[model samples]
Target: MNYVLYAVPFFFLLIGLELLADRWRKVSTYRLADAINSLSAGVLSTTVGLLTKVVGLLTYTFAWQHWGVFELSAQNLWVWLFAFVFYDFCYYWNHRLGHERNVLWAAHSVHHQSEEYNLSTALRQTSTGWIFGWVFYLPMALVGVPPLVFLTVAALNLLYQFWVHTRHIPKLGWFEWVFISPSNHRVHHAQNAVYMDRNYGGVFIVWDRLFGTFQEELDEEPVVFGVTTPLASWNPLWANLQFYVVLWRDAVLAESWWDKLRIWFMRTGWRPADVAAKYPQSKADLSQFVKFHVPLRPAQQLYAGLQFVLYVAAGSFLLATGANQSVAVLLGSCAWMAFGLYVLGLWLENRPQALGLEVLRLLLNAPALWLAEQAGLLPISTLGWSLLGLYSLASALALVLVARRGSAALPA
Candidate 1:
């Protein structure tokens, strides 16, 4: 089943409901725009993922075909299932290590950069996760999981994660111990000392429970979200690049080359003494103002929740459909989607210039999509029509959004 395409609408529907529920219960603590921006990153990233998968598939088929793993995978579904489960187990380590190591943290920090925690946070994924990120999944290949099942299970695992990002859910009794609940996951997103680098789990919290990385949410000191060095700006590209840029600057600033080299691989919080001394550590307590600024009204809360569900449903559909799609087509579509939404979200949040750019992109994409269909870049199917319609609607909404701002400042 092309589960992802269906998941996209499902995601929007649920997110909309979640938003409305927040308004009713008054539990939300994030802005609608920020949440939407985060989700836009998510939609863009999921679309970007199509390219990575295409590259991965080609490398697996033509290049790695002679390997023993493919042979083993050809015969055994059980092997595929085991590999799928084991891969997630390994993911827990990769995730845990991402928080613990500075180099990995630089890449992983994109997901955590969102100050707001909501369904969109699940969508606030990293575009460059293919770097070193693929390494964690290799064990599945080694153990003979066919590329197809590996991707399907991987997508399913990711799809499972969508609902976990919400703040509307409380701790789920014993489920909290065995699963990644909103409360526990919120602690993982926290930059607070007690919560930092803890609760590394994907579908199952059992890994965190067994690994000693798990930390229960504290009522005494509420979870203060975001990184120690807060990303104050709203630019998506800046969010992605900030840690790398910081790492490079610190490398240059270090008096000794060893300190420069040492810092990037060290624990995430580690900084050279001089850097620490000059910059000082930031421990902004978000708890005080969180209640005042973030909670949503019942209707708006549901609307946001529904919006998220819709993006996920759309993203997942494309992801699953593109899994088997030709590499060239997948890559081309992703190039448009990732860069488009990434910039659009930025325009919506930080800069107005991108609004014009997004307009150009929207204009170009419609004809490009039609041409792609004519050129057989994509199959003309019901699913394709649905995607085209939704994307068109989304793009139109994006343009209207520019006008809605009432900035009246055209591109300079």
Candidate 2:
């Protein structure tokens, strides 16, 4: 069962509720561009996962069938109970090492790039985590947990975590000590030195407390969300690749072969001595920290928002049917989605070339729609094609008007 896909509507519904709470409290917990960027990363992750998730699933299934020490039955009630707790135990380590190790951090850092704590932030996830993250759960496979049980429990663990990303919820006194609560999970997202790399549990906070990585949300030191080194762009692609690029650059510059190779597995921020001296990167001072923003004019925001809704609708379709798609078809769909998202990011950043890129994207819609139909990915009728052409033409006109309004708002 595709559990995450089924939960999509509920996710947005809760986010809407959180937005209402923010209004009632007179607090601004979401910025439109940031929320969009976070959602873009999530959408990208889910799209990418369609192609990548097989790596972990295949490995776990192979291990369970060939070499599992016990024959755990999925039909047993105790097995479900045991696997539910065990999955989180494995997730605790997978998450902890994601923060502690360099190469792992490169993939996991996308989630922390968001500067705001809101329900949307819960959807922000890493695209490349399947590379090494699967190894953490091998113990469960070895102990004979069936693939179906593992998958279900893992999904449940993830679903349970969604609500904890909001700032509207206060600390639940005893709940904070046992299960992962909104308050303690907020600390998990904090970059403040005291809170950094703490609270690695998924469903239960007991693992964190037992493992000595727990840190309570403190009133004295209010949490500052985001990483020490901020991802200053709205680009979802860049958000995923930013740290990997940094690591690669450092590795290439290192004088010693050993440093070049070891840097990937070393502690999260460890750099080669030669690279550090020549090109130093300083962490942002928390006291002087500012959230990254590129203010969009109201017209620009409306255009971007409207365009994003179209992409979301398309993405939902892809998610629902992706498992049945051929690799070639899936790749083609993902490429177009990635391009659309990149252009959207440019618009969010208010780049000067945004108008041109968006115009290009609008123009590409005809060919893309035709190609998708050819591939049987979209069953568009003659009327659907006409509607698409009309959409493209209208979008181009809107883009030009938005550009003019933005230019008029700027100083001479």
Candidate 3:
């Protein structure tokens, strides 16, 4: 069973409740664009995972079948318990190394790009983590944890980490010592000098306490969320690729062949001496930090939000049905979703060409839906097609009205 898929509605419900809590506390933690961008990255991650997950599953299955010393039964309660703890143990190192190494951090940085600490920020995940993430859990497979048990515990471990992303939760007295709480996790997300690479556990705080990476949230030094190199754009695609792009450029520019190869696996933030001298990178001052933002009119914000709702609906359908789809269908669906999201990011940035791209997207959607139906990838009734038509028309009309009202002026 796909627990993450089933938990989708509940996640949104908690996000809504968090919003209410923010209101009650008289604090503003959710920004429309930032929240939407965070969720968009999440949706993209899940959508891309649908296509890439086979790599991890197949690798795990191969390892277990080939090298298992014991055949663990899922029915055993103790097996489940052990797997849960062991998964967190593996996750601690995976997460710690992700922050410590340059290439690993390239894929992991998406989660920290959000300046706001909220439920939505929790969903900001990497689409490319599968490239190296599977290696972390091989110990579980070697120890003969059943695949089903391993998957269930992995999902539960992830779900447990979601609630810790909020700012509303205060530090628990004793619980903070053993388990990850919002306060400690906030330190993990902070860019402050004291908090930069600390608190790398997912569910258990003991890992950090034992490994010497733990840092307490200090009253004198409040946590400032986001990376040292601010992701200045709201683009979800760019968010995932920004660090990789930086590394790629550095690798290309490095004069020494050894530095070119080592630049990727070297310590996080390490640059070749030659590249550093030629193309200096500036670090933000933690004491005087400012968030990256692009101004948008109210109408533009509303339009972007409404369009995101439709994307969510489409993404939910894909997640629920993707397992049963053929490779072609899954890839096609992912590509379409990714394009739509990229276009949405452009719209949020108020790009001059966004309106034209949106029109193209709407026009292309009719054929895309029709093709999916014909390919038997999606079930489309007459009403479904009618609704699609109506939605496209409505969105186009909204774009026109927003543009004519001079609210969505193209960025100069």
Compose the digit string of candidate 2's lDDT tens values, residues 1-412: 9899899999999999998999999999999999999999999999988899999999999999999999999889999999999999999999999999999999999999899999999999988998999999999999999999999999999999999999888999988888999999999999999999999999999999998999999999999999987899999999999999999999999999999999999999999999999999888889988999997778889899899988888888889999998898888888988999999999999888877888888888889988888888889998998888788888888877887887788799
Model 3 collision count: 0
Worst 10 residues of 1 by lDDT: 288-297
TM-score, per-candidate, Cα-based? 0.76, 0.98, 0.98
In angstroms, how far off is 362's CA in candidate 3?
A: 1.1
TM-score: model 2 vs. ground truth: 0.98
Q: Which residue pairs of candidate 3 clash?
A: none
Backbone collisions counted per model: 25, 0, 0
Global lDDT scores for all candidate models: 0.71, 0.92, 0.93
> Which 10 consecutive positions of candidate 3 have the poorest summed lDDT?
403-412
343-396: candidate 3 lDDT, tens digit per residue:
999999988999999899889899999989988977899999999989988998
Give me candidate 1's TM-score against the actual structure.
0.76
